[model samples]
Target: MDLIKTEKSIEDTNKTNNQIESIFTSFMENTLFKDKFVLQASYTPETISHREEQIAQIASILAPVLRGERTSNLFVYGKTGTGKTLSVQRVRNELLKRDINSNNLIIEYINCKLKQVSDTEYRIFAELIKKLGGNVPATGLPTGQVYNKFLELIDNEKKLIVIIFDEIDHAVNKITDNFLYNLTRLNTELSKSQISIVGISNNLTFLDEIDPRVRSSLGEEEVVFPPYNALQLQDILNERASRAFMPDVLEEGVISKCSAYAAREHGDARRALDLLRIAGEVAERNGLKKVTLKDIDFANEKIEKDKILEIVTTEPRQFQLVLLSIIDIVEKNERLKDNLSSSIFTGEVYNNYQRLCEKTKNDPLTQRRVSDILSEFDMMGMINSSVISKGRQGRTRQIKLVIPKALVPKVKKILIDAIHLS
Candidate 1:
């Protein structure tokens, strides 16, 4: 008993000595961005904290009184990361706060960003319904049936249901538009749950592609949230600092610098917050007491590296090959035009690809896949393609790299380095 007591005392003392909560607390308090809306935990946040006007605008449009007339719908369009998702989420919360009856007011947020094909809409529809405790099946159901089931749940919610289709552009391809049309039109025939759709998209041209009938249904209201300016971003950072940080661990310049960078990227508050948090991490990794200007710079580089690689990884294999080939072509030619005919460009890509793999001693991918990738690259905005006749061969689509003719050298260098290093 005496030996055990001594051991326990020693162990407790050692554990106490090893613990560094007080020191770590300083780091934790300084950089944690706790804005629920901005962090987008449930949805996106009102990080800028002044979208109250927009939030109220969205809420007023879908006000509960509109339930009987099939919900009046809405569409929000803007560039990427302009707080569309976050704004819609803020409105959802506000709507729910106003004496929402679980059976009546049903708010569902579906991120179509991850769903691509037409059929996937059915899945998203089912998931949204399931989240609301609707009787949604596990799959194998017909699209019509699943859609009907989704409507049935909406009907049951019967008061005011606000559905947010976030990143709607990603899934706006030909096959998946059925769900969009139906959701807007569901109440035209029946009066169960009035649903007002709040579609959030980055593409300004998304509305042009929707069928006239769908557009008519979806044109209930439109509100565009502008990106934050640097001054606005700095204010946002200050607001967050009080709640998220502990002491003077965060420097004043941190907010300004992050704001400047984020402002340059269209004044995205989320980006600013991300930079600040990442800067703190860089500091922590380097065993620094607090994040500083140097750490922020390092974080910026890291963000750029990760962003570029992520952009590349998401590209189709053919596009990746095309990009890789362009890097090699620029290296060899020393001078390439901003736009070359697709026929000539494809030749360059194919030839350079062969040479690059040989020099790097890497196995070359087949040309068929390369062709497919190039097509996708064009589609995904990596390069441009157009049909041009090749004499007796008839019209064939030509391809060209859209990158600045001068910047091609740097882009090529980075891409090649990424390939061999990774």
Candidate 2:
């Protein structure tokens, strides 16, 4: 019996290997993508469409840098996928090209959304120093020491330094806005060199939230980028689609469907491009020659699931604990197979949350705080919450998980692993 079982296992392994090999062979033989990177976010076209005015404005603002003059600190605000980063990068590249003969101007860019590089003040300074050809120990040095090192490196010569901080608000959230004040004040301490800043944020009201002191020191010239409309999105999609896929690979209306979906997302061109790219992948996987409307729908569902899982992975411990408690309640109720809705009350979730906090040896937040987290989750579409009032008894929220039944197991596993729950 053992010999037969071992033989069967070997057969199954061989079958799996053959299946994988066949999939790879199919990918190589009949792929749809001509150049998939054309649909990627990083690919900068020679001429950016629908952003000419914004690009020209940014260029005019920074044009003084070409003549070794300190330009006004610029603040750029826009929603995601509004071509803010691409326009700024294009202008920066132009400045570099125009000033190639002189080493008097230096420009650097940092993405503050990256956790490892910008979660703390020290790491931000360290990353900047490293970019300027200086190295510091990753840790063990005081933040002030790291700041001094950066100042010394940049002030060693008579040059103008322009540092662009992308997603600057995210950095401020992790650290304080005092760093901005310190950075903007650097010019006063330097005798030969001057420093300028270009802050970019997806938050429309980011500047309003910062310290008034930092705001005054920044002295920023503001630029706002409006979201694209559906027609505009169609134009953008048409250009990228022509380059991203082989001719005749996309079924009719696929681009239109993608544009509509993205327009509903506030004209996010990046999301539209992602949809097109992923739909192509779905088609290729299904061994279909053309990307159809059905493929786009399937890709959308996949992206939604993946986006939720990503949120689960990145949320704070307390947020995860709260979500886990809700998931546990819903799952237990699911097993009972009651005819009623799976929705539970805020009180029940709080109770389960308290147990989880105890099990993990973490302090439990107040019911009010947990409810606030639940409201945030509702905004993120992870759950549906409603207020129900019972006269003098006051009111409570009716909560239900919005995560698809198919994703519950994966969500539970991630929560368990992240919280170290037994």
Candidate 3:
């Protein structure tokens, strides 16, 4: 009986291998992409459509670099996928191309969202030093020494150094606004070279959180990029699709549906491109010649799941605790077959949240603050909240988790691990 079972298992393994080979063979034969990179978010096209005004504005602001003069520190504000970074990059490229002297201008870009790069003031200075052809120990050195090394590297040359801090708010949040104040004050210390800052953030009100001195220096010139409209997104999709896919690979209405989906997401062109690319991938995996509406649907669901997971993972400690409290209520109600599962009250969530905070040894935020987080959750589509009048008892919000029942367990696990809940 053992030998017979071994032979049966070998046969099953061979069958599975053959099935995998078939799928690979199909993928190789009917690949739908002609130039997949065109659909990627990182692709910088020869011409950026629908952002001419923003580009011109950035170019004008930074044009002083051509005369070997220090340009005003520029603050760029925009929502995600609104072409802020791209426009700034376009201007940077154009400036480099037009400037006759390269040594007089040095431009460095640091993405503050990147790990191991902008977590603290030391890392930020270390990154800048390395970018300027200087090296320092990754750790164990005093931050002042690293700052001196950076200043020395830039000051040795008679050039204007422009450091672009993308997602600058993240760095400020991690390492206070004192760093910004020091950077701005460095101009008074430097004898040869002047330094300018280009701060970029997705938050419109990021400046409001900064110290007034830092804000005045860092936001000398401000540019805001508005979200693209549905038509603008459609234009972008049509242009990218022409190059990203093979002839007749995308079925009719797929582009429109993808554009509409991204439009509802505040006109996120990156999301639209991702939707189209993922839809094509889904079609190819299914051995289809052309992407269909069903493929778009599948892609949307996949992106939604990924977006929610990312949001939950990166949220603040309080957010995770609040979300966990909701998850617990929902799970307990489901297990007990209770009818109140759909109408979890705010007071109940607050009570559970307090318990979670106590267990984690965290000082809980005020009830008003927790209520604000729930409102934010509602805005983010993680929950549905409705205000119910209790007549003489006052008013309370009726809360329900909208995070697809299937995803609840994974979100719960992330919250549990993040908060170290046993």
Candidate 4:
């Protein structure tokens, strides 16, 4: 063996330090390396699993159609992230696995959140007709005609049809269950196909808003999924972690922290998974192989930026602008003695909207139109309103945000950067 050289040892040490620093710098760009391809918060096969009970309930409702038998329409209810959408999709995927399409089975899943833009839920019906290979001729056709075209398409296919409307709350637009009434009419008016509808909603109020007959038809068979318990949430988080991380890389207490946090709040499995995935990303960005419990805790606090961005991306331009104004005005007025009242807030919000337009060179929507945007926020649970006694006005309402006060500044920053950060 050659004799040790002190000068060589120093060179080796410098090289090793450089490699370590390089790894950390790389982590800054790819926070959750393990979850690079995992869709943390989405409704897809890769992101959904372990929903056995809810899946079974959905199966029992849809079994009839798979067996060439007719069944009543089904309505699924639960608070946010109770796996209502995931369960329906799990069942749908299983039904698809049966792969007897030619033997007569058709399934369609639509996000009523998009299709239910107007008072009616006919957009999805038009989509369904296209899926079934029928032309409804989109020349300002009445909803009645669009529905008839849907039936005609299904009749031509001669296959049992299972239509799932995710976010069904959007369909009625506060009172438009006419779609459900006509859908359940298949057993009578549109008898050519065995049509069964599966509706997934986070709002329980939609059920109350529907016509009694439509409610009866929808609830012919119903299932409600409660939020996951701590133990259940742990299992879900652990399972996701296993797929989302390399072996032994996550610290011992990370999943437990994520589970406890989620259970304490809403027991939302989706939220828990999001926190975990975000934490891992954070850890990876820091160039650490192990994700610590502290990392997960930090993720719980920091992930709202991602959620706010998601909301901004999904909304139309004016709605997104209105939301940005709410965040900005609240943040600028954050130091006030009493959080400014809604009236003052609205005026400030309108001004902020105009400034944003000037900055981005985009046109500002009318103030009345902005009020309409507020109505949408109300439905989406992003904000709340309080009815106040305005002397003779007899209880005019004032708007307030329902989002966490802590998230206000962060949301404001994100929206501002989205518009002006070049």
Candidate 5:
């Protein structure tokens, strides 16, 4: 009887294991996504929407390369997710397709925002060398040696090379503008090959801080991408949805809500797609057949929380302290009065920040430095700051937290723990 009972237990375990595997297989087979990657920002669509003028302009500038002529270096500026990178890449793809057999053109694309790739002058040149079919060590080599090797490699090829530097400002902020000068000046040393640069930046004033000579050389033809409106964003989402999701998986008004939310926040198509994707994931997790408006709300909440946590945890110590100061001010004001507003000015924030620094035994930055950090925080969407004039009292920025109110306590706790304050 004991032997029979043990064998029956083994059989039952096997049956349960098989049932779990079958359930997982069924879940995978019935997912709403036909091709989920089509919704990702990195996945460039075969056709771009609402960027015809910019595409034509970029194509015209790069068209000269097909005829073996050196085109002018181009600069493109726009807010994040305005399709600058996509448009430029699309044009490059077309150029490659046209020159499939000619072997007369070489396109090197590097995003400076990526670490260890385009973070410094050495890394940028090293990447360029490797992309040109030459190998260079990641580090420990003299900068001049890297430049010489890159120059030699390019001079050996009689092809037209176009280098696109996406997020050029990140590297420029970390290092000097000498890399730009070096790239612009490479043409003078090359005998057979010609190099043209396409620089893409989201910062409109990025050129103002760079060396004048570098700016003049790199901005021969500049293109600006305007932010997309609600209608444009909706169209983009609809096109992507048609490819990414199974039919009728998304309920009506889901796309519209995503588009409207992103359109209100500078018309970011990337954010809209992220919202839709996350909402679909939420629906799938809840075993819902269709993504609904409530799922979008949940997705927005999740995205905001994740973004806040990421920024707070990864940002510099000083930035974390500044954010903490804002949270403290808002919480204190709310506790003190039922109707008091929590909005504060730069001067007030700096004062509170200095106090926090002193209490923590850290050296405080000057008010000017704090102001600059505030501007960066504003750009990151952690805070909203508007310049307001006080007539004869001069101008100052009115600052308010953009972080979700529900997430404030969590942010406060994280900041407190990070600073090691009791």
Candidate 6:
């Protein structure tokens, strides 16, 4: 009798599994996405909108490589999400399409922010060597040997090579400008091949900080990418929306609102695209047939909250403690009903932070160090710090939380748990 009961249970479980599979398949068939990747930030469209002038300029600079002549090293500068990386990549794609049969050309792209690949001078050289079909271990080799192998590999090929360093500033900050100096100075030593570099950065002032010789060699020509205005952002969103969504899936005014919000925050095209994508996901999750303005608002809030959580979770413990101190002040102000604002002066925050450090059995950082951390938080958009002065009282920074009130409880909980764990 026990065996028979077990057999019946197995039959029921199989039936339930089949039903679950059928439900998932039905949902996939009904999703609003036609080609969802078109709305992704990494997807490069066949035709780029509103960047024709920039593309034409870059193409002209790189055009010399096709005729067996060396191209000038190029520097591209723009704010984040202003299309600097995409335009360069697009130009390179076009060049490769035209040079398909010309094995005499090679193009390599590296993002310096990538972990264990371009983070240091040795790792960057190791990556370049491996890309050229040469063998080099990720570690266990001296820097000089890695450089020699890279040079030898490049010298063997009688081809014109173009190497693009995206976010070159990160590498410079980590390992200094020596790597760039070496690459720029290498052209004279090569006998059989020619090389060019295209450096892309979001920081406009980075060039001024590098060695003058390195700067002159690396920046033969420079191009600046301007941010897209609201109308231009709208046009871009419309183009991608047509390809990404089913007919009439997006309600009226949805794209316009997303574009406007992003434009107000420095005209970031990536932000606009993210808003649209997340809105669609939210609508689909709610089983809605169309994405509406309400969905966009919800997505915006969710994205901001998630960004705050990410910043808080990844920050150093000291930074987290500083944030908690700010939170404690805000809570105290609320309870007192003193009619005074929640914003606290830096000195008071430092005192509270010290007390919290003692409670957690951690040595407190110096006041100057805490002030520096506060400045960093201000730069990161997590908090606002402004300098204020009273007559003969000198000057101090006034700090306030920038995140929404609703998020304070969540942040406080995380900080408490982290403090206990430590």
TM-score of each candidate structure, all chains considered together: 0.71, 0.89, 0.85, 0.71, 0.82, 0.92
lDDT of 3: 0.90
Model 4: lDDT of residue 130: 73
lDDT of 3 by residue, 365-394 (tens): 999999999999999999999999989988
**C-alpha lDDT (0 to 100) for residue 358 of candidate 3:** 92
lDDT value, candidate 4, whole model: 0.73
Query: Using TM-score as the measure, which candidate wins?
Result: 6
| Candidate 6 per-residue C-alpha lDDT over 22-132 given as tens digits, one digit per residue, 9 for 90 to 100 | 767756866888888998887988887899999999999999998878999999998887888999999999898899887788999999998767899998888888888
- Whichever of 1 and 6 has more TM-score, that candidate is 6
Question: How does residue 267 of candidate 5 score in lDDT?
Answer: 92
lDDT of 2 by residue, 314-356 (tens): 9999999999999999988988995397788899999999998
Alpha carbon lDDT at 197, candidate 4: 82
Clashing pairs for model 1 are 29-245, 37-44, 37-45, 38-45, 118-176, 155-193, 318-373, 319-373, 342-398, 342-399
Taking the tens digit of each residue's C-alpha lDDT, what string does model 4 give over 142-208? 8777877766777874677788888888777743566678777775765567777888888877788
Worst 10 residues of 1 by lDDT: 36-45
Quantify how close model 5 is to the true structure by its C-alpha RMSD in Å: 5.3
Q: Which pairs clash in model 2?
A: none
- The ten-residue window of minimal lDDT in model 6 covers 1-10
The runs of at least 3 residues in candidate 2 whose Cα sits more than 4 Å from the true structure, single-residue gaps closed, are 1-14, 217-219, 313-321, 331-342, 353-366, 413-421
lDDT of each: 0.67, 0.91, 0.90, 0.73, 0.90, 0.90
Worst 10 residues of 4 by lDDT: 337-346
Candidate 3 runs further than 4 Å off: 1-5, 99-102, 310-325, 331-341, 347-380, 386-397, 409-422
Query: lDDT (0-100) at residue 5 of candidate 3?
Result: 60
- Candidate 6 achieves a global lDDT of 0.90
